[model samples]
Target: MNQHLRRLAFACTLFYTAAFASASQEKAKAPDAPAATRSRTLVIEPFMRVTNSSPTVVELQIALRKFTAPGGKGPAVWLSAVSHIGETNYYGALQKHLDAQALVLFEGVQARASTNAPAPEAARGAPTKEPAATQPAAPAKAAAPPDKSAKQTSIQHTLAESLGLVFQLEAIDYKRATFRNSDLSIQELQKIMEGDPDDPADASPAKKNEQLDRLVKVMDGSSFVGKMFAGVIQIIGTSPRLQGLTRLALIETLGQIRGDITQMNGLPPDMQTLMKVLIVERNRAVMKDLKSELEKAEPAKSISIFYGAGHMEDFERRLRRELKLEPGETLWLPAFSVDLQKAGLSKFETEMIRGMVKKQMEVILP
Candidate 1:
């Protein structure tokens, strides 16, 4: 299989477990430094001023964890133990980090229902004068267009909704904006998969699976190898010994996205290039827009760049090296947790399961 496809498959498997469980910041002050040195402070740093009044700007990086509380709402973790931040505290701090007057930027396109009305006339507020009764009846309003925003959804939006939390940046009172609007929509990505000449999109679903099967067999030198690995995980997960364990302890259960995700460095060069297009380039656009906003924002106002966790490392590098912003003190929010102790499993059983899970993770993660 193509390395990208293999990685894709691993991700898909995790999603399946998610459905089963689906119902289931710090700061420091610094003394004034030289102009060039001051330029190196983080956006949140007091010394980092977009204007003389000194508006604080910061970025909040997030990963998806359950939005509901830990009682059977969906997949979750023990707040403090795993990722070190709890769900409630995570959202609470996020709200606190976002100041009232700051502009909030999100990673999505601004969408609204399509309409035929003239832009100027609608934006002008009440018409200056009522049109004469004789004026030709405005062409019967084309069946009022459907609400476009209603239909449009992004991963970020969906995840937030699932958690029953909303970003202040997304609030009507806030000046919400998107750093880049030219991202590939879901339909566009689907088209790419369908249009690839080697693997035409028009194939029947069964045929596509057959093709994928053949590809995997060739790539791994045995069609059964992938199934065997999955079977091992399934056995480890469902064994009676593990019955008392929480869903989080299941070897293949989803929502275990913890630890450093730096393994992208091990991917083939071509795969790396693909990821750069998917992630890094989008961030460059974000930084470009951010620079413009910083220059224009009112002094003493704050700004928040809320984006995925994966983007932060690269963004911080760009901030310090390119934008002359230095890293400030760190804050950790509990995003996901799996309370093995709560599952009532014995220490010996937990260790055995952890060993199996770790072995499987090692095999697939890199």
Candidate 2:
């Protein structure tokens, strides 16, 4: 296998899984003040990413409609981070709680299939066109065609259906946002690796070839480590006893994302550069799109941006410093539950595990 291609694949696997992963702080309650005096909520939460095989955990989220603006009844906005894969029950629940006219905006949305494309002739053809003999003696009734309008259901669309809300289809296209493509290009990367004293960014074919060879060697060595780490993270995130501790670990790991490439032990500098490009630059781009959406939104509307927990710190700071939006409430939703009954742990053992989690959190935070 080409080392460069293998490295790209490995990095993408890790990025897809970790992209939606987030950490949560202890849950907090909304104020008990009257609706007339209540401030609109800007929810900040961490979420654990899930797949079909993983145990379903609580999805930490903020529904802006929950914080109604006083004397201002209208739709709220939900800005989300995850890409649209398929339909799920979670979006259904969210739709039930939002305003009828609310809007849900998602980040990194793909360019939609063209609406103007010619409709299929088969769709318009009569079902009973064939002759009686040509069709079987007792022709089976053809099944109803699937609804094309509802085919591409992202979290936004699913929620929109129940909420009677509209979606502002303005997210960046998925092609431009992938792990390898979103970051610095290979040629640019080669220039950085081959720094010059007079012209630090000077590029040459020899230097490019040299850098490519080095990258190939480095990727071959690190592929196993990357895969192993990704598997370990997923396991810890789903296990009953270690899930909480895993949150703390993820927070610590993502927190150091801004550090220099030299600090990334074991991984090649090129790989480290790609990781930074994937996490940092991509997040900033998401934030920029979100800011644009917010500006276009109507004033006094309650709006929420549902993103990964690691992003909350930077986003919150930006909102406060640049946009003047302050968080009014924050909460935690458990991604999954530990069933002691299923695990068959003694009460003493359960207490011991809880104590250990608390201790680990204390050490990891502050």
Candidate 3:
């Protein structure tokens, strides 16, 4: 039983790390420009990374990358990749930096209507369809609701507390006037995941729902794995030493897969499809809003897309191919750090933990 729990804990750690690393919210609008041709090359620098200051300390960092049009003619756009949870000071620094921007296109899925009745377009307060070419501006909407799914507990929040960190939603202020909702509505996200009835190529609704339920259970801490993982986290939370070790394992795992798109290859088919909707489809919505903003007579001089680090790669592609933007300066911010020495770990134990995490990641990632 003890060995079983240990294996379960390691699996859960890797799964959640990958899920969070690749996770963010989005919508289904098509891009204004032709799709960028796929290439084997990477166009932008990695937006997330893990670094070892010494054998006894490690750090997880996120990047805020800036981009601009040819000769830096247009607005300076910043893609601020963020972790869903991090140190309080990390969020504070990020919030201050973003507050200087004239417009902030942020990511957060809106709430589902409680009933079957369609939510009014105006109540939702954003363009339901793609913005017309002649339209100068898209309708402004309030920041999206705090949680994506009404039924699920805020997994990010729970994880933050367990790790002695702060949740992004709580730490960053989204209520500012400069911030705009640039993600898929929960209804739209569900429609995409449910598969189009007219398109026979899409998966069956029942199958999609089954996969979605499994995902929700894992995220909401209701699945056997989630329950066991949460129990492990709770135990870790009680001890500074355990929390430090868990943080180290997460850093190592995340660093190994940072900005590697192939990491999705390990996911089940159904879950992969869901990730597509979450990352790719929603990215379209962001580009849609960005286009509208750029079309404005007086667009913001500096605009920022505040989203999860997982969304940065796709966003970089869209900005380059669709908008003809060029990458510029990159600012790295530390999100989480652990001091193994302070946590009572020695060189032998630290190396042992690193070895175990590496072995597990090898099994999970192709």
Candidate 4:
């Protein structure tokens, strides 16, 4: 192995030791870092920034556990796309790090038309300019163009409404701005999907998946949806409105999509990165905004987010810098801990999950 790999391995080891010890303090109390020495930090990843480089998946998982070290009072940890993207990359490693508990999953795309949209022209006291009573006789009214936003809202609402039936969180990709819009429809979306393409067997998985994904969208591209979601994520990242419930809603939305996400309409490969921006990066943006929100919302004892694994790098870095992340600070609490307990492992098994997570950190982030 090269020197770089060796160093990484060593770093992973130290972090894993620290994290595992902290989460399972029953073994031995991890040394407490001085309180004032730290400012609360958020952990994010460079999944967006780093490309063409294959960071060890195992190593990254190790790092995740360390950063998300549960039972630590330092910084909080949030992870997403952890199990959704490339095989064995993030979510693939999840088999080992069962300690990671995701609170929400993304649903679908929805956004306000613009980030800086002014209040409705009417609301601003702007006088309405009525059309002139010109010479032409009135023709029969045509059918109304579909309301794109409303279409998306119905889908999102339906999905959210259905989520509690199965998962603990509401998984989704929809944005609030999109929900605010009144124009959208299931028929319009189906028409959009109908024109996309047919999949050939030889096509790559990504391509096939993109095609399949679009089949599910029922609508064509909505730039309004895209930009709106980006804006809301930006708003959530920096705004003071972030409360645990809101964050929970977001996490649950994303998580619910994990299983339901079908590759009917595959997006461009670049969109893989974009989705990360939508899901994970937005989480960072929301948390960055959360600093201000924390004063009011009373941030959770902890929160776990699961989205595209690709966004892990970008979001984790953002969390560290913005949230003042400390190692082993954020613990990935498992929502299904009891489920794991019943899976044949005793309390000792739970400790094993903690150790497994620690091992991944030890393996990856050195």
Candidate 5:
């Protein structure tokens, strides 16, 4: 049972990490050190990472990168990779940064009926010549019925509470005028996953949905394993020692995985397909919106794409290939960090937990 629980924890951790990667900044004064004397910072990877700043302190950081068209003639684009859950101030800082942009293309899948079809003017990716004051406001549509599949407990919210952090939706204000939805409707995603009826090459929708449902149950704390996982999360939440140990374990596990989307090749076919849809197909939607915006007669001077870290790599590629954009500056935001000593873990205990996590990763990843 103990071994089973351990495996379950690892599985749950990996899934959420990937899914959310498929979903912060401390203002620190720079030291007055000479450039040559300063320690070299680690090269930024594609999206998320786990870094150890000290022997006892570890952090999980997400990336925000800038890209621009050739000769810097067009509007600059920013790819802000975010976690589904993070420190309060991190989101606050992120919000401040995004508020500076003329437009923000964000990710949020809604029901088909609830999704607002882009206006004909916006569809053409051009600003209407009519004055803003002359344009009538859109009527508020009735809310779509709640999705049954989404009734399950939110794993991201639960994990946020357990870790004393905040969920992204609760922390970031998405209602701003600058924000625009650039994701598929939930029904559209489901249809794609369901596969085409006439194409035998497509995987069976029933089989795929069944597999997806099982995974959702596990993630949302509905299944037996999920209950056990929630119990573990609760225990970790209540005990500082457990929190510290769990943080260490997570750091080790995430360190090995490194938020590389390719690492998901080891997962089951259904899961791989799910991720492909979640990251790739949705990315196509975002790029479509991006191209539309760029085609506008007077496009926003600056635009930002706020999406799960897992999707950034594909977005980067699209920006480079389709838009002919060049990568520019990058910023690392600390999402979650923990001090082993402060959390009541000794040096030996930290090392021990890390060793255990490494062994589990060996089995899981191998």
Candidate 6:
């Protein structure tokens, strides 16, 4: 009887162990769930490219709106960086239409998915004991990037490609340089531009010297501070303390001023001062704008706003941190594809695109 009891206990232990191992295997195969579930959201769609060539942005926005509607969400918002670049007067046009939880921007750099991975293991109660030996298995690896034939085909993608080339050039050239407080004078700035102080500054995002003149004219009657700020932004996008920004944000801001300044020719100093405070003052205004939106609860009519991907952190992690949006709810619209037949590319152009995306579709499974 004693021998039989011992046999029964051993068999039960084996059965339990097998069950636990099977469950663990199943968990490993499941997909990584999304970061945001179906939390109500309003997305403001913006297309940064110029007009008349291709309406890819508007088309994609419409497609996304249609796709999300069946899920019973609100209308998507509309605003374009190209169109809103200049505010000839006070910032008013879109103000009336703006209201939401937050205008989350994207810098397009969210590769790290684990914040906890870097935390202290002891704090997480990591195991320290030597356990029984088991059959060795290969270590799991990262999922392969989406496949190449599956290259992003949307207009945003084409813009992203063209803009990526531009961003890389700017980074190589204008990475932050130290400037002494004594060097913050108009004469020095002019010299920097004239001297071509940065070797191979061909990649600098600044426009021609004429562009700076136009900005000065726009702030004609404004305070000297305004003129200084505008000049500073042109020379350096942000203070060194706030470095590591996507150049797109600064380029877009400067683009608006460069475009609007031409209209401000002969304006009084005060008018120019207003533009100064409006255009060049980045951090505070942005934080305030973001805070206001995040505080505003999602109404029945809310949508998503796509700004610089950098702004996404302030919205997702900083502002709406409490909401803890589940992964499935935060929708990343799949970039659209172009029909090869309709693209009308020369054989060379087609080959170039294919080569660029050869890595796009190839999934390197480990």
**Index of the highest-lDDT prediction:** 3
Give a tens-digit lDDT track for model 1, residues 1-366: 233332332343343222111100101112235687656644421111111111211112233221112233321111111111124555565545443323434333122112332232131111112336633455222112212343223222233333233322243222222111212222232333344343333454345444434432322224464444333334323333232232333222223333223232244443322233334334544555556655653422444455544344345545545544434334444343334444444557545544554555565343
Model 5, residue 91: C-alpha shift (Å): 1.1
Instruction: Write one digit per residue (lDDT tens) for candidate 6, span 153-191.
Output: 221222223222211111111111110000012222333
Candidate 2 colliding pairs: 57-335, 57-336, 58-334, 58-335, 58-336
Q: How would you encode candidate 3's per-residue C-alpha lDDT over 206-288 as one tens digit per residue?
A: 77666656665666677886676666666656667666767777777766653444344567555656665566566766787
Model 4: lDDT of residue 358: 46
Instruction: Output the lDDT of residue 15, model 1.
Output: 33
Model 5 Cα lDDT, one tens digit per residue, 21-136: 43311011122445653454333355667888788688888889999978889899999988777789889989988889988877655322244443322322122122467445
Winner by lDDT between candidate 5 and candidate 3: 3
In lDDT terms, how accurate is model 5? 0.63
Ranking by TM-score: 3, 5, 1, 2, 4, 6
TM-score of 2: 0.39
Report the Cα lDDT for residue 173, model 3.
76
Report each candidate's C-alpha RMSD, comma-separated, in the order given: 15.7, 16.0, 5.2, 19.9, 9.1, 29.5
Worst 10 residues of 3 by lDDT: 122-131
User: Would you give me the overall lDDT of model 1?
Assistant: 0.33
Scored by CA lDDT, what does every candidate get? 0.33, 0.33, 0.68, 0.30, 0.63, 0.25
2 or 6, greater by lDDT: 2
48-79: candidate 4 lDDT, tens digit per residue: 21111222111122223334333555335445
TM-score of each: 0.42, 0.39, 0.82, 0.27, 0.76, 0.23
Residue 81 Cα positional deviation in candidate 6, in Å, after optimal superposition: 11
For residue 211, model 5's alpha carbon misses the true position, in angstroms, by 3.6
Winner by TM-score between candidate 6 and candidate 1: 1
Report the lDDT tens digits of candidate 2 across residue range 24-103. 11111221445643445534343323222234221223223132224424433333332222123333433332223233
